[model samples]
Target: MTLDEQLKQLAIEAQCHLAKTPERQRSLSRLISIICQSNKLVRPFQGQFQGVYEEIYAEAQQRLFLYLCKEIDRYNPELEVMQWANFLMKKRFFIEASRDLLPTIPKGVDRSRIKRSPLEVLEKQTPIASQVNASLTEEIIQCIQEDHDRLFQTTHIEHKPAANFQYIALQFLAGYSWKEISEELDVKVVTLSSFYGRCLTKFAPKFKAYLSQ
Candidate 1:
């Protein structure tokens, strides 16, 4: 049988075995192994990361296993299970690759070139908070919001950030951890962190001016 036909057969068998209490674990394990071993699933990332392909492939398999376990009940026999599995595996691969490939800021960069965290900047202004009028505080916040919107526009023109960059930044401003943002946004934590770094690089000067004012 062809790969698709083989996958359909496996899906049928897997569902049947899942329905049986005694065979469920064994069948699931076997099915996961079969899926992980497919050339089509593993070929995309093979030999791509130099010495880390094995590591990435292992992580991808682990992620795929978890996904399959969570989504087993929702599996539809009418659809191609292998295709779904391929997509999940590929996504996991890219996430792992992104984590491994995220660039680091160079040491000895000027402090002024680094953007201050919004929360940190806000905290530094606390001593002056009592002296400032309410309208002034509101205006400052409005100015910061405008700066964020402007960065969002400029970055789109320049770097074309992932679609969720704005939401990620808003969540960061609201004091969410990268882990929390990852879970809430269905994005990898590393990807969000990297994107945030890029945003800081581009927005540092404007943010620094805002903080100074």
Candidate 2:
């Protein structure tokens, strides 16, 4: 049987409408393990994994499984299970995991090879004053908003002149997903993320220097 058919069969057996019993729960758990562990289902995330993402992968994966265990009923079978599972993984858990890793990065480290999220960078750097939070984030955000120098406004994403860094940063800060931005700007998520990192590396320090003056 095709993997798709097999998943449907599992869903039927694990339907939450069945009688509430420990045996039913155990059987459902076993089925969820099979679905979550399927190599084909998780290959998308696994294949694209890199840098800081690999560090929390295993932990995030457990949370994904636990999510399926309790919320599998929420899964829309009309959607391919793989897409459904990975979407939840990215939207619900991975975004937060990436944010938690951002502040720990070495400030001077090269970002050429390190893949991090725009959300991870900005969400961690808030205007709040506390021992844990830094004011650098506030300064960079201010520079993006004010742009008296027009640097951020003119710094487009490579050839995509319409996608200025100022606009991209606002979208990220406003809680738009990278996928949404990519679709809107007709760019790949990979390209947009890499460009944002380079922009931060090039622009953030300059903003800080001016702010410190």
RMSD of 2: 19.5
Candidate RMSDs in Å, in order, are 21.7, 19.5
In angstroms, the error of model 2 at 178 is: 26
- Provide the TM-score for each candidate, comma-separated: 0.39, 0.41
Clashes of 1: 0
Q: What is the C-alpha lDDT of each candidate?
A: 0.49, 0.56
Model 1 lDDT tens row, 57-77: 544454455446534656788
lDDT of 2 at 67: 50
* TM-score of model 1 vs. true structure: 0.39
- lDDT for model 2 comes to 0.56
What lDDT would candidate 1 get against the real structure?
0.49
Off by over 4 Å in 1: 16-20, 45-48, 96-213
The candidate that achieves the highest lDDT relative to the unseen native structure: 2
